[model samples]
Target: MKAGFSAFERYKMKGRFKWIAAAAAVILCVGLLFACKKDKGKEQEDISESTEAQAQAQASGEEGESEPARAEEEDPNKLEDGMMRSYLSGLPVDEKIGNRRPVAIMLNNLEAAQPMSGISKADVVYEYVVEGGITRLMGLFENYDDLDKIGSVRSCREYFVYTALEFDAIYMHFGQAAYAVDLLAQDYVDNLNGLGEAGDTCFYRTTDRQAPHNVYTSASGIEAGIKKLGYREDHYDGYKGKFKFCDLNEVVTNEGGGSAKHIEPDYKINKPWFDYNEKTGKYDRYQYGAPQIDELTGEQLSYDNIILQYNKWAQLDQKDYLAFDCHSGGIIQYCTKGMFTIGTWRRDVDSAKDGNVDMAPVRYYDMDGNEIEINNGKTFVCVIQDSALEDIVLE
Candidate 1:
């Protein structure tokens, strides 16, 4: 019976060993499958990482190549379609018009010269007090090809010639003040005087007005005079423009500025004022209690920017012909977008390499000493006596 029990135990042990062997074989097969999957997954992950690295490298190379081109496209100074910005208005214009020098025509602002012809085409207008508390207008026209009549043209003041020099403009006048004769005779001063040899070629007298107020100029006459005089029609090779302008789509709100809904320069004569028009986003001009309109278009004169530049001034002689210190620094009131900024203006005459004061631009700066950026449109600049600061009003 002991021998029989031993045999059964041996058989049971053998069966148990067979079952354990089968279990071992199953475990080894499962381990092998898991190892194969892990290796396959690692290989796939390595490929993915390599591809990602290559893609990143390609992207970086592309970004490096396109960055400058993209920046150039975004540049505000860059224009499209062979166009250039107007130095006078800061608006886009033809390359030819933008490159040419502007014509600065003197306009009579007296009551008799009401509804001045072709004055609306002026990109920039300057008003300065002359003798007898009266102000004269100097209109700087950049694109005047279509203008048939400009100004009831008036006499030039020495100060006006200096102002025209700031823009490198070709000065045009029917006559000049006696004090201006010597200055106008200077070789650097290229002016078309109606009383000089170019008078018949550059200007004509209208039948409707008296002698002094009757002189007028046209685009054809101006072109004729320019050709006859052989004046340089193009701007200087490296001429830097005055008045930095905002981009085409940009709008300067004059941040931290004062209200400028109504501006009154408080001139004793003419009594010129500006009222902000919300609809047109411009300041409509009024003088002598009436809208200042252009005779050619019959449209009321308006401006996008108005500058009241207060300068130290003196009477030259008994005639009251004034001399404004254009080189010296002065207080400035710059108004735009129904807002006004108190600033300062200075022309660095001493810094001019050529010793030409007219070539120096009168730069405007804010209280913080940052150059003020004006809007892109027609501008009206009023040269007021510094003592008359109290007389000026802005609301």
Candidate 2:
């Protein structure tokens, strides 16, 4: 019985060993398959990383690639908005900037003349506070199509400082010059030589079209330039040069839309001085009429008379007087002394005091771009042209 039990135990032991060996082999095969799968996944991940790195390096212009563009930023306007957009991180232009980003709407619009195409003599006139010289002379003609080939003003756009309000820039050309010229103290013509013409290229940036072009030379040339180059008014139906000029006497709507009092100019600039002494002083203020360089010139005019004549006109017409000096371009032509001086004489006071004029004469200059721009000695004419603003007229 004992021998039979020993045989059964040995057979059971062999069977158990065989089963354990088979299980071990299966475990080994599973481990090898998992290892191969991990190795293949690692290889694929490396290839994907390499491709991504190569693409980044190309965009950065590295690895013998062409150099990226140097930053050449220029301010379109000194306005706060312009500066913010160009320099700030989150600006529209900055967000859309390269890696070859799409062009902006404004940039695209600027490329097209659509913003400027439609203008009329009555609708818009982009005025410039310009100095005389070839710029003013050439500007008088406005758009020169023949000169456009030579970089006429058309190559450049304009920003306008409407009356007292600055930074409200509009894209104006051609008839725009007319508005600027009319406000520019008329003495701009007198200062042409002071602007200093160089060989052949135009240099005045504030006034000239762009640069390096001298297509027109005189007032007639300026007029021709306007016609030949197709003025903004010519392109658009509603526009006329009239929008450039404003009559101080006329009441107009507030475009920017604000209080009618503050926004609507009271011609207070013209009468700035009138308010000063009218309240506290005598009922009649003193202003000298027709300030002349010569006390005995009868008409009270300078040796060259235009400046003094202008001052005299100011006294009579607007009660605003200016002095003339040799320094003032237009008034200098009429200087009696090397420097002529003028004062305000209240005519109303003078009449009451038996020709005794009350004066508040000052030394003024044109550098400030005031109504009286010349040295306090120079005067300006208050010549107001009362013509109908262009009412949608065309040739």
Name model 2 segments beyond 4 Å from true: 1-158, 161-217, 227-235, 240-395
Error of 1 at 151 (Å): 1.1
The residue ranges of model 1 lying beyond 4 angstroms of the native Cα positions read: 1-73, 348-353
Across 1-395, the per-residue lDDT of candidate 1 in tens digits comes to 01111211333445531221222232123222210000112233445776677667677774445434323446756788879989998999998999999999999999988879999999999999999999999999988999888889989888898788888889999887876776787766789999898999999988898877888999999999989898999888767678888878676767556788999997889999999999999999999999999998989999999999987666655777677766657778888878887777998564342667656778887766777888899999999877777667888
Cα deviation at 279, candidate 2, in Å, is 17
| Model 1's TM-score against the true structure | 0.81
Question: What TM-scores do the predictions have?
Answer: 0.81, 0.15
lDDT of each: 0.80, 0.20
